[model samples]
Target: MNSLLILALILFGFTSFYFGKSRIKKVTEKGDLRPKALPHFYGYYQALWCALPAFLIIAIWTVFEPIILKNLIENKIQISSLNEISQDELNLIYSQIISFSQGNFSGQVTKGIEAGAITYKNLLSISQGAKVSLFFCTIIAASLFAFRQINKNVHAREGVEKTLTIILFLSSVAAILTTIGIIFSLLFETIQFFTKINPLDFFFGLGWSPQKAFISDPTNLTPQEAKDLKEAFGAVPLFAGTAFIAFIAMCVAVPIGLYSGIYLAEYATSKQRKWGKPIIEILAGVPTVVYGFFAALTVGPFFRVIGDSIGLEVSSESALAAGLVMGVMIIPFVSSLSDDVINAVPQSLREGSYAMGATKSETIKKVIFPAALPGIVGSILLAVSRAIGETMIVVMAAGLAANLTINPLEATTTITTQIVMILVGDQEFTSAKTQSAFALGLTLFVLTLILNFIALRIVKKYREKYD
Candidate 1:
């Protein structure tokens, strides 16, 4: 039933879009020159006009229907002389109604709940049916109206074009609003975190032990005892661990990924890419969870033996093991994106340089690489973002100890690891530890946004040079 409604909506939208466009075309071609915008633009305008309003209504209706309907039904049930019920009883009735309506409840249904379920079903049917019919009617009518408006001196094409421009503007605004919503959610939660934990302690404190915070005691600590909690919330070690891992991962991934990317884009024969590309992409499809145990059990202990031979200390869960594995994980991310960007660099520039007696390597370094630098940098930043956001490798191989030291043999933690630890056990939502997760998440998100913005700016400036 739900699938049928969705199909009906899609058909209604498609029909309105095409039929509206054709109507404009027919009217404009009938010795009328000034059609409002292009015929295609008129179609787009009509389709958006028809679809957006109804879809938005449907979306909003879906979100609030339960709450609104439940309230109305609850009030009706409470006032009934047929009932002697408490708030909890009314709530139970509401639950049963919802469950039964959704085809979830199986036992014999009560009269009030059964009636409410019927009403719920009726409301869903009416809303969905009305949306489809209303949009269809609106589109058909609007198309006819637009067609009638088209005449010899009507300037129909311009009107259609203007409407299309508005549609595009609205779409862009919607995207921006969504981004703003995400940022606000992160920001608000971070604020809650700061309220519970000292901002300075979270940011500047040197001891980094969050798991200890979770190691609950039966006796709640006094205020003075809690003041000592600052000793455990060290940002320094976590920051160092994160940087060390990222740097090591980059050490392995960067040269290999960049060279592979350059080869695929600039040097590879078509046949080499036929198998190589898919083979490389296959690496990305492996689950991170699979990589987790591989890093922890295999690489961690393997590195331990190597370090023992070399007379260097190596913890079973060392930063090196995790970083190396993570680098291998992100190689495709670096290679694939860089390959496309490098390929996009103008062939004319490369040919011109080669014609000037520049060696292949010289042309690549002085011309091709410079031209593709912005895109390459963008890809690297994206990889960095991915590395920073990665959780599984660190959680498994990079043992969680918020120790403020960078020695790879010593245990260390990451912001993500801290979040997982703080929130893992029975967390008190109002506690400083739980809220710290939000603060870390916000910081990560903001850093990624900054990197992305810089990358885009570099790419844009580079584009202007050629364009």
Candidate 2:
């Protein structure tokens, strides 16, 4: 079935290419008027016209196929036994029926199961077959349509190129829609979680613990479960932890990355850049997992030992280890982006400063740095986001105690770490624990979005001055 779909897609591309090339030739040779676009534009136009709508149909079909197929099976399966089942129970039965249909059922298949399985198998087979058939139909139709318009005397090139420009615009719009869809999905899930828990308690509570209030075992939950599960899921610890870790990381990273970027951009000769740049970037290439172990086994323990010697109390897992290591990891982010922004400043501007008898340091600090401030701010915001969302480093090195206190030596957990803890390994999505992950995810998303917005606004405001 996959092979058939691939074949149809190949035919779609081949026919469009042929028709477009043929149209361009006819316009160039037979038409008296000069062509408005190059021959390749015609090919691109027809290829896009033929492929886009058909591809969208395929993509949409693939996303909703499983749900639609399940419903169609429920309708077609002649078993009256499923009629009395609730939606959840029916969904469970449907899942098993699907497993059976796919020839991977673990249990004995009764007659009713066999009948439903057969229907589901037939539906899946027919739906996929229809996709392949429709793909070929769209190809043949679009190819013939393009070919017919590209007669021996038609102006096919101009018409096709104009169409291609519109197609390109449409493709960009799709990205905007996809972003909207993602935001809405996150918002919906967050609303559901908040409905189960008080928003105020979740946001402002200082308890900083989730494991304490979660009805860990659903089987053991009483007949009547208490509502307002949000009170149990406090964001204070996660929020404080995220801010504290990011603050520590920025403390470690910003000065070093900023000074190095300044030196590289303004002071370093070409020879210095040739060797030093890659060495700096090598730090970025090291895997986060390796950093995780370094944080867990080496840095955290090392800090604890150091703290003990200094008469300070340090936990086995300290925020200092994760934040410090994360800071090192993101240094390349700061340096590389800052370097670009600094380089973007016009040499003419620098020369103007020098002509005014400004010392090099004075000129750089006053003229060059101010000119590139926007880019530097943009890079810092991006690094802030990286620090906030970073998981592996904090998860291993910073303990998941959700301690709301702000001691670097004490154990703490971030939103990302809690999300990981809640969803990792075995998870039951119906529980508050699992829902809290989504809530945390929504919070993380909102935080990043706001940070990015501020960064973009600052960059834009600065860009206007330079422009």
lDDT of each: 0.76, 0.80
Taking the tens digit of each residue's C-alpha lDDT, what string does model 2 give over 114-223? 88887777888899888877876876687666666554334546666667677689888998999889888767778877766678888897765556556755345454
Clashing pairs in 2: 197-230
**Per-residue CA lDDT of candidate 1, range 1-467, in tens?**
43565566677668767876777667657865556466766666556555656565566656886687788778877776465888888888888888999999987887877888888777767766766676557555655555455433355456656766887999999999999998898788788766556778877887765545542441476666576666656576677777788887888888889999988877889999877878887878999988889999999999899989999989998888888899998899899988988888899998999999999889888888888888788779878877887889999998877655567665566778877877886867666567667788787777677878878887777653665
Candidate 1: Cα lDDT at 168:
92
